[model samples]
Target chain A: MESTANNRVIHVRELVKKFGDFVANDHLNFDVYAGEIFGFLGANGAGKTTAMKILCGLQRPSSGTIEVAGFDVYKQSDQIKKNIGYMSQRFSLYEDLTVKENFQFYGGIYGLSATEIKDRTRQMLESLQMTTSADMILRDIPLGWKQKLAFSVAMVHRPKIVFLDEPTGGVDPITRRQFWEMIYEAASKGVTVFVTTHYMDEAEYCNRISIMVDGRIEALDSPAALKAKYNAATMDEVFIRLARAGVRSMNG
Target chain B: MRIIFYILQKEFRQIFRDKVMLPIIIVIPMIQLFILSYTATFEIKNTRLSIVDQDKSTTSRALISKFSGSSFFTIASYETSYEDGMERIKTGTTDQLLVIGKDTEKKLSRKEEASVLLVTNAINGSAASLMNAYASGIINDFNRFILEDQGPAGAVPALIAVQSRHWYNPKLDYKTFMVPGILVLLVTLIGMFLSGMNIVKEKEKGTIEQINVTPIKKYQFMIGKLLPFWLLALFELMIGLAFARLVFSIPMEGSVVLLLGIASVYLLVVLGLGLLASTVSDTMQQAMFISWFFVVIFILMSGLFTPVESMPAWAQNLNRLNPVAYFIQINRMIMLKGSGFQEVSGLFVALCVYAAAILSIAVKRYKKTA
Candidate 1:
């Protein structure tokens, strides 16, 4: 198929990452279009984090032609960083800071003016119905609220892409649903969502999903397409089918 | 510049929010200054003396009385036999023993030379020299007393009466000498350990992952990491100097501004060392251990408790690179000797060079990309 480079926010060609003799990403090829919820599905040790880090400008790729937001990873990582937001399973909000303060800090570091940070912080607190908890320390907030606050803070700069590395790993189903709704809202606003999750049910929420097995992309298609291709009834079955055929352990 | 200010704001907030750390950073060092100054002394008091006078004459008794009257010596015993005086010294009951030979008064009356034997415990060599000097001073006083009693007409002038004037600290107060050194230590510890552990704490908690992904420059991050502790260390120095003046009555011989200016550069060296430690270790424990290893070395060799002049030549040469040593030396010179900027400029320049080297190394080692 002919590729549409203008529509793609992320382009990875012949991507390879290695740690010593171990290959974490083996010559992967993919493209993620703008404003799409792209699910990067993998078991533990399937090089999910290594690839995410490379894309986030937090790790160097051993060898690859990877571009995010139209900036080369090797030469223009600073530009790439300026145009991306990141949230992780281990939340990045400072526990010592108030909810409003956390928003202000992230906004300030992202090069927002003081007046802009002040305005955005107030708007964020009001929108989340967290005006009452704005002054409350993050450590005192409920975990679900903290996760939501972390997501909002990560998006404070409104970058073109947001990388979510298992962003809802330990949340209840209701909170996870709420978090996915936030992702969808962001995606609707022309923000590309690149997320990784262990939940097969959550994987079904993506527009396109790629399953990696043993440092290589084993399948790439929509949830229904992948299920049909694997002759399976559920994403779990599809995942299990591919995972069992792999040699790398979940602990790798 | 703006990004670095954000980091500084975050660090200051976190530091002040920690209730346990606030007191540890400010109060503990003040308490240490008060307690350690009084106890860290070199003054030797109450040297126990034993004397065996074989001559049993009035002259011998007068000489013995002189030793007993002196405040430096406490006459432990007046043993008649030499063996008893020797036994007292061997048992460590007496620090020194004086033995006056037979017919000491008869020899003086005949204008012949007289002799006395002085023995001291040389285990502590410095204290032993002091004890020997005190003993000889007492015996010389007795010789003058005898000559005056024999009706001499303002006899021959004595050999070289050295008029010694101790400048600055005329009283030779060890507290005056030690207070400034301890202040350097407090500042160095606060600057090094706090900043060192701060970065590693973020690393251990995985907060650095988000920070690493940010567009902030490396120098901006390092400046943000260092500024709070650098300011805090200077504040701690102020408290230390205040205590030195009010509590110890340590006179501020030089300009407080000059002292603080030098201390500010010294803080860079210490805080830079902390940043260096953080870059080498991934965990707070590892960072603490690494910083502690160097802190202990710097403190011991800082000329705080012992004179740097007395240390072996190689150790002293190695001390040229030690920031603590330079700070301690500069602090004492300024506080005790009333030294001017011109006097401390060499050390000040050395510290600036050292700080620049270490901080640049730390910034270089700190990886934005994992």
Candidate 2:
């Protein structure tokens, strides 16, 4: 899709993030349009998390011009934070708290009114078919349910953009598919979704995917286009081909 | 401010929800207060005394009766030989041996100076010194009585008397001294360890990443985190003060309002230390270790168990940085001495400055961005 300034939810340019002498994100550039499911694909240490963290205002870039939800990363990060929701790879909800309490807490911090929080929580629990488990502590629930609940909690405040850092990391395939459906439903409601994952098949669900190799975006295109460009049969083959070639060039 | 309320609500829920932690936070410290107050004492009571009376004179027997009458001593064995009495001390059956030389009455008749020997088990130096002091006091009293009896009753010679009176705690009750200091320690423990561990737990559980990504201000998050424990510490102090009055009968001589006011400022110093520890540590274990290191040093050097003046010069200087030392001093002054704000104002100002400096550094160090 052709993107305009009005439709762009995230704009990153020449973004460079360094840790002392090590460059974790090197001169990156990307733009995410409104309601788009953008996949950030990289190896374990390929700087996708670093870039995502910067976009979410959880970390500052060493030198860059970056904007999230129309707010500058450095100058207006607080504003940016208000307009975005984030779920880390590690579970973030309080395990000792009941499911409903977690919803109230997150929504409350985002300045949602009590009635709004209650209404949203009820609707979310109904849609997730977790109405019966509202009073149950998070630790007692299964991992898949916790992941799904985490995503719903992230959307409790109806953020303009929701950043999911490998939200479906350790779930079964069926649960992962269910999670993607949730993402799709959120996107259909015009919420931009920024996600990072290693699952090649999951990348196919994104509107567009960016592949990072060695702190640099090696490819940015739709999954079909990437497959055609790399002349690979599957996204798995395309990822391996790009990663190996990138490693070879770096070695040489 | 409403956001802070929500954060505080969440923190209180989590704190109260933990089955293991709730009791540990509430009940354990009160139990410690009871145990430590009753057992940790400096007063030497019922010290076992072994006597060897070689002189069977009436004056020597009178001296033996004098020691037996005193409440501080328990006459365990009466041996005829000095070596037998010394054996009682070596065997730990007695704390000290009192040996009276022969011709004790004859020496008095000749107007000669007679000396009684006291040998104490000095293994425990402080206890031994205290035992020696009690024994020497009895001997001196007996000598005075003998002089009075030998001299003309109506024409008694004038002698200078040293009258020593203990102020604040007239009875010299160890509980009275210990309860206030121990109360400071409990409050500091609750403030420092709980606040520090609460934040680092978020880090360990990866929940801090979620909080950091939110729009909550740093000071709001910190206040929310520290306020609950601060209040809890104060509540603990109140409970401790009640126990001091009802159970230990420790006098609350100063104004309760003034004590609480100083306690609130002191809590800021401890809570700020906790926050600083949390900011530097990435796990609950690390935070606990860091807090324990400071707290153990603070409590030991705080003059809770011993007098601060007796410590080495460098240790006394180092205690200037110890928040526990300052609070313990303030607590003792107000609770025991009935000291008002005017008396503790210098220390109070120092605590206020410390609170400001520590809290500012903690807030600055606690970065929302990694």
Candidate 3:
């Protein structure tokens, strides 16, 4: 892990995002190393999604020097988009399309050859044990299966980084565990995972996590280290301590 | 280019899979064409006429026979009193009243003019005017007949005659004029609504975000979004043209290829407008309302139901910005008059410029980042 620490996939310096007078991400600074699962945790409207959007090149920051997959978010956003994959919580896959068709379409747009797409699609379906359901329309599938398929489709292009925005929001805990396993597998293959979530238990699965409070990162380190520093029993307690401080600042 | 191909493939698949949308794209326009072409017309076949004949003479009887014999007027009743004839018109039972004055023949024989009164229901202004024209024409023919009969062969005063001929449509079949214009309308409807709703649907479904985050070029995505509807609209125009030719037997005097070429360019303008509407709107409902607002304005001002020549000068000036008006005019000229490319070259250039301008605006407005 120490040997791979020098390979920085995401670098941010003094990132400031303002929607009118309200700053969504204020002077944020962070770096995500290669093959690392970086968890972004925040309560609702804490600006986690906004920060993730900026990192994915889905939005332009009001002011920032940010980079994703070694490409500058401002100048090389198109190149950054090519190297990164994104899946939102809104279920972005086409419900009318079949599982295999979704995979082929996402792969094809990324300039993958037809045979390569077919091979990867078959491999993905077989691994997910969804081979028989490949031809089934996506709308008929269960929500958990759809979530899994969306993540796999996001990886169909073999992007260097995958941005999952609340990828397991509505899924069962068992399914979320499986989702984490998939994320770990991708990370093992040197695909950096940038995921945002509300579940503190899920944050424990990250090698290192950042807890954002009121548009700023209040704490960022390994979950065990954050718990130890806060003198808390679990990540949940650490999160509560930081979030209460954010609440105090709001009232002040 | 390959990316565009895949996007088109995905879009075509989704469109075909929607059973509700498929029929709307293909069947509804044809139904509108068949119904509107027949129902929306200017030809007044039956105008009920009542006669108040006070003069019981050969001249008056001959005139009554003239009104009854003509196909334009159906004599609803014959009354002794003028009030009774007018009552038929007031009650909506008759469209016009023809009153023959007393001693009309006696006055004509004395080489003096005889006056007859025609009271027309001017409720519907244009229809009333047409009925008036037909009645006056028949009365003129009667005067000419009386002149030829009463005077010596060469002693009749010489009068300048106006022989009017209706060209392009010799028989003045209304469908020949209407079908081309309606065809332009249906094509515009399909192009504008489908392409506009399509992009907004992707936005609503959150699929647009997925496509946006990809490395796909903006032009490639736009082309993918628009080309399928463009082809579908052109195909619809072809089917409409075939229906026009076969069912109505509307004369296609112009080159089919030229009409289609012009239609293709016109479709770009319409499709671009739809795409533009999609970019500004978030939901399919908003896009539909925006499209409806524009479509209603364009259709009314398109000269489809009324002649542009008769429109107020300000409206005519405003119509210079109307793409539908330009295309309908081009369609009528080509299909009815057999106009060549050279004849419509100026309008063709205008359409080209409009297409380029509208499409670029749509492209520019569609923000990938947003």
Q: Residue-wise lDDT of candidate 2 within B276-341, one digit each (tens)?
A: 999999988889999999999899999998889999999999998988889889988999899999
The C-alpha TM-scores of every prediction are: 0.91, 0.94, 0.94
In candidate 1, the residue pairs with backbone N, CA or C atoms under 3 Å apart (3 or more residues apart, or in different chains) clash, namely: none
As a whole number from 0 to 100, the lDDT of residue A199 in candidate 1 is 98
- Write the residue-wise lDDT of candidate 3 on B273-294 in tens digits: 9999999999999999999999
Which model, 1 or 2, shows the larger TM-score? Answer: 2
Computed on alpha carbons, the lDDT of every model, listed in order, comes to 0.90, 0.91, 0.92
Model 3's CAPRI class?
medium
Candidate 1 lDDT over residue span B43-135, tens digit each: 766899898989999888888888888899898988988899989989999999899999998998897889999999999998898888888
Q: How accurate is chain B of model 2, given as a TM-score from 0 to 1?
A: 0.94
- Model 3 chain A: worst 10 consecutive residues (lDDT sum): A243-252
| Clash list (residue pairs), candidate 2 | none
Candidate 2 chain A worst ten-residue window by lDDT = A243-252
User: What is candidate 3's CA lDDT for residue A182?
Assistant: 94
